[model samples]
Target chain A: MTTNGGADLTRLIEPDRVHRSVYTDDAIFAREMEAIFQRAWVYVGHESQVKQPGDYCTALLGQQPLIMVRHSDGAVYVLYNRCAHRGALLCAKSRGNTGGAFGCSYHSWQYRTDGTLESIPLPAGYEGTRFSPGAADYNLKRAARVESYRGFVFASLSPSGPALAEFLGEARIALDNMCDRAPAGEVEIVPTCFRFIQHSNWKIFMENQLDALHPYVTHESTGRAAAELERQMMARKQKPPLEYHYLSAFTTPFNEWDKLQTVNYPYGHCMLQGYMGLRPRDPDTLAYEAVMREHYGAERTERILGVNIHHVLIYPGLSVQPALQQLRAARPLAPNRTLTEIWHFRLKGAPEAIYRRALAYYNLINSPSTMVNADDLENFWRCHQGLAADGGDWVSFHRNAGQDDEHDGVIASRRGTSEAPMRNQFRAWKQYLSSSEH
Target chain B: MPVVIKKRSRKKAITPKKNSFAQFRVSDDDVILREVEQFLYRQAELLDAKRWSDYIELFDADGIYWMPASLEQITGDGMPSIFYEDRNLMTMRMKRIAHPHAWSQTPAWGTSHIVSNVTLEKVDSRTGDVSVRSRFHMMEFRRDASRHFAGVYHHELRKTKHGYTIRLQRTDMVNGEAPFDYVLLAWV
Candidate 1:
């Protein structure tokens, strides 16, 4: 239950409670960055993000900076964003096309889009020296492995884990549903994003995504206001706009949320089912359904639309709401600080109205300026600040502990409000950290 | 906050109605311009003074309050916007913030919206509608943290016997592209 320095990592997590130090200790955060984030199948970027041959975007795996580039042969590459000459970072911007090769601004060392060394400033100066342009060390170092599933690319720092598809397992449905919504069977990344920094540990953000119990309490004010307006509209014999229900849905009673379920799998992949009633029988939706039925058969389209998933957590970093066409990635900067990038996508061949629906949800729920997000961010900061003090020793996960069902390594929570996702996460955390070869 | 003044890109043609307000002199009289400026200052005062009801009365029945996610964003119809509220939604926002259990506003936000650079942009003689552009710097403080938001405001005002009612109010923040510290839950 403890680490080498006498800090008990095992004691930090119990069946129903976790020690406060798991979230606040600097040593634990460092170990998590090295063992879990760096070694897991961490999502890098989408292939659509770099469609053009020379297009590139920057990402982070744990604390290490990485660049996801599209090579001339139309393959996506994940490489360390560093110069071979020194440790200076290459590609200072967040995203841009590098043309044919990346020329490091410091010392002018150049490399191809696939991280292969291209040229050096002076070949004669290194003639008698040990420096060789063709040396493997001179090329940009890539992550140990890189792979893609349905255009969502991921990379692992350590080479000894399961393949990306095997790692995703049941969670792969999240990405499939997102792409299947498009008639063309693809989706494109919207270039602009909302990047936000929450003053809390990254785990807080991840846990909140599937913690169905908190919305009713945390967003009560916003939900209540929307509910009031909805009532007024109903009284006036007018159907309230769908946007109002988006906020009012947070006021869903505990009994309703309890009827839902959380499916947990090995490697910490999990999903919370049907929190949002995305299948509204509206005119815009009807038109989009017709198109989907045309492209995919009626039966197939119905099955795809009936997946009933609300949110999927891809283990450590990514949280995807496939139905909403939005995905969020969390990157931990410190034990007390985390950065989240919220990106929304458009179904490639869906109607413009459907895209607009997703866009509205993006602005209303996911944007940093929304009441929904503001409420959650405040709690994250407050939780971190509270845990840092001596007031509380343990964070509880006792809601529906002994009630969960396990079969063939997959765990299913008996109730939606169960803290099974958090329990599953920590169980994976222990496995990743304890293993000598992650 | 650092001021970022990016050079306007040449890809999209600039709309003259949004840019040439100061270039052409409309109606040799300055009375309407002064009234527009006064109305704007009073709106800012009402918001800072927490007169939520009085502030809501300043808008027309069909007015919209919009803040686009980016300065380059031209339309709010299909694009992601930070704040896009009709009268009903705006009323809901007011009600939510005033609620006792609004946790984000536990220690209520103290905001000072400094309004300046009021300029008359356009006048629609047919509909008695006028457009004005101004700049704002809002300082918000809450729960031991303080932040400032600087932005340009574009207002479309409809004249009535009672005064001018807002048809549309759009805020384009200067630093809209950067990552925020937490959340922006107020009028930007």
Candidate 2:
């Protein structure tokens, strides 16, 4: 468990508790960036973000800036954002079309969309020197490996590891369910996202996405207010819109949340069973269902809609609510700083009303301005602050430790409130940190 | 806090009453402009005072409070927005913020708004509707942190018997795309 400096990393994690330093120590955070984020197939960006040949988007993979660009060869490439010549950033914007090549702002060195060196200024100056344009070093350095599943692209910094699909395993259902919901069996990104920085660690945000017990407690006020309004509307003989229930559902009692289940997969991935009843007989929903039925037939449509997934945590980075068409990607900047990109998708060929429903959830429940998100962010900050103080040394994960059902390395929680997801994550974390390879 | 009950109406385009301002002389333009500015000032005051009910009362039954995520966003219907709420949703937000268990509002944040650059963009000569543009800089302080938000405000005011009520209040934040430290809980 100890590294070369004799820092006991193994002692940091226990079966039912974790050392406070895991969330606060700078050395641990740096190790995690190299061991887990760089080794794992980290999510970069959706392929839909760069649909056209020259379109490109920038993302961060464990402090390494990367560009996901579509090439003229009808293939997507993941390359380092740095210019090979002077090490300046190739693309400054978050996303844009590079036209035919990525032109560096500092030196005007241009590389093709596929990251090969297309041209460089002043070729005569480099003729007598060792500098050669054809050298692979002069071309933009690509990720060790890049793969996409259902348009969700991911890249690994290490050359050797499990394939993207093998790593995804059962967790791939999250992406599958989302795509299958679309009549055309595809989903498109909404072009823009809500980028927020939490004054907390990245793991805090990841753990919270599947913490079933906190919603009713943290968002009680929002739920109560929405429920009260719904009551008044019903009293006035009016049916409240479906959007109201989106907040009111937070009032779900703890016992009901316990009735749900969390399935933990290898590689720290986890899934929470759907609790919010997304299906309704509203006119908009009925029309959407009719279209789905027409495109997928009755049996297939029912199966797609019946996936019953609420949220999927593709550990260390992504949290996806497939049924809601929302995904949040977390990027750690420091021990106390984490940046999250919240994105919503439009199900291709689905009715506009369905997209509007997703938009409502995005703005009202997930956006930075929402009461729900505000309370969660507040708690995250407080959790980080408390962990950093000397008041506590160990953070408890003993909710239902020994009660989980395990089969073939997969853990299933007996109750939804079990901390099995955290345990599962640390299990992977320990393996990753203990490995000698970088 | 006493709740104000208002009849809610479905969304409808605000139409100016025909020739409502026909009798007004050119000299009265300044007076009308001052009134619009005063109305906006009052709205800011209510917000700063945490007078949720009073703030909600400034909106028409069908009025919309919108904060677009991008400057290019034209409609709040299909595109994602930071905020797009009708009176009902605003009322819900008001109640939630005032609730005792609203953890984010703990050690309640204080906001000071500076409203300036008030300009009357257009006056509907037919119905007396007014379109006003203004700029605002709001400083919000909580526990140990202070954050500033600067935005341009576009208000569509409907002439009412008592005064002018907001039909639409759109806030276009200059740093809408910038990364926020946490959540934005209050109106700017």
Candidate 3:
């Protein structure tokens, strides 16, 4: 679309570069909402969000507000929130038990949990009219497809998407790694979430999710302070407290981040290997591992436990960390305004202390209250604001580009600290953007 | 922290006695009820005026400040939570705000606590610990804007050698999961 004549679509988004307007322009963002967000398989909600027969929660896919609800027959449905009678928006609350039917407060038009029109407030109103109940337009519209992968829900507004699993490809590992880590091969949603608005383009945050390089730089001061305290405690020759690692991990030298490899898969999905060294020999962790071993056999259990992914990105939307049970979805509002949902999870049938460990990471690092998250938000806002001014044209991504390694369509970094992740993402972007219209 | 109550005029006829929580032999006395009410009211006064450090000292070392993940997390065996903090964690949270990197704190939220319905729930005989419950309607203000938050506090207190020290403080925030207007850089 950016090209005029019979030029290459892929050239604009080559591995080494991307158009500046992807961040600084408004029109490109709208096209993205239509072509990418509306068409791609976007995550809807976790099964735990709507466990009961009639539980429902509101979610956003791009600019469209969609609701994910559980029907009476136990199937999940994704439906548009607009009411038929007077265009009243349904499901006013963020989340609640819909009680088997959705009733519009404006006209009181009732709909079944599955999104069919159950009844109108008055029967005689449409008696000799075109407003028939059986009409497809009269019923609440459902998304084109709703699919679940290991209890994680996804919806595609378009009728065609390669199916959720095929689209996921090897990125399926993200969810599999998440669920399989649980002793029972399942993880429950942390019902509540911490939602915050960032005054930046969504792409910046997505790129930063698995940057695999900025943590040691952006978080150096805070991490160094905490690491020093930990060093002092260690000098006394006693085991340092757990909180010390929280700060000291940021003190990882620049070269160490390079050692942590990043893998960018097709469809914009990518992964950053974990370096938190969270596998501690504490009693609580040992008890958790014992429960894990009890549920899964030794080899399979070892495989699941061996996975060390820090972040797994599912393309232009969600960033998932399976090990820590962290899921964050970015919804682009305006050219500059983006909203993110911060969700943590609990592995079912696991010890309470295990959940507490996840909670500590959530609160201390990811929570809005935490210093780590606060630092990220400030940079996000500042970057967006600075890009808005008439000072610059391009935001560079040419860091160690020529040195990337690729084989059989699977791109890997040469050095662990290479910029191959961004290049790989742009590779997928060009593929999507350059394809002939379906 | 900002408490939103004005000083009350001395009453001509305060209620004689009401057995809300502990039925101490002294609980039946009118003087004890009045004294207990005054204690809670004074604490509220200190909290409403941004005296956060002073309010935190009212808790014991082993105190817990909890805001449950969901209404069903009574036994702490469900999803992660709004907050499940011990005293040390709470102290660390406060310390982060004093730093320069907390963007939300750059222009910090100015919060006012509208506490009401103070009622003593029960009393223990062995250690003289008292349990109290209260409701709060808090209005968090930032950038000339305000958002309303309401919650109930379940306070478990112990009578120390000097004064009351809180063992547990659970604030059940209904709006905890709602997209926050700004990050809570300090205690509310």
| Error of model 3, residue B171, in angstroms | 3.6
lDDT of 1: 0.87
Top model by DockQ, which number? 1
Candidate 3 chain A: worst-modelled 10 consecutive residues by lDDT: A1-10
Put down candidate 2 lDDT per residue, A1-438, tens digits, no spaces.
223431468668899999888898888888899888988999999999998999999999998999999999889999999998879998889999998999989889999998999998888787679888898999999999999999999999999989999999999998999999999999999987898999999999888889999999999999999999999889989888898998999999999999999999999999999888888789999999999999999999999988888899997799999999999999999999999999999999999999988988999987868879889999999999999899968899999999999999999999999999999989888878878343
| Residues A1-438 of candidate 1: C-alpha lDDT, one tens digit per residue | 234542356667788888888898888899889889999999998888999999999998999999999999998999999999987898999999999999989888889999989998876787778887888899999999999999999999998999998999999999999999888898888877898999999999988989989988999999999999899889989788886778999889888988899999889889999766799999999999999999999999999899888899998999998998999999999999999999989899899988887887898888867878888999999999999999978999999998999998799999999999999988888788778433
The full ranking of all candidates by lDDT, starting with the best, is 2, 1, 3
Across B1-188, the per-residue lDDT of candidate 3 in tens digits comes to 33334323254244333522322343333343454556666666666665656766777887877776556567433335566666555555555554455455555467677677766677666776778778888777765578787888787888877868878877777776667544655555
Weakest ten-residue segment in model 1 chain A by summed lDDT: A1-10
Q: For model 1, what is the alpha-carbon lDDT of residue B110?
A: 79
- Candidate 3 versus truth, CA RMSD in Å, comes to 5.8
- Candidate rank order under DockQ: 1, 2, 3
The alpha-carbon deviation from the true structure for residue A394 of candidate 3, after best TM-score superposition, in angstroms, is 1.2
Badly placed stretches (over 4 Å) of model 2 are: A1-7, B1-26
Global Cα lDDT for candidate 2:
0.90
Pick by lDDT: 1 or 3, better one: 1
lDDT of 1 by residue, B55-172 (tens): 8889899888888888988877677888887778778888888878789888657789999988887877677678999999998888878988898999999999899999899989
TM-score against native, each model:
0.93, 0.94, 0.83
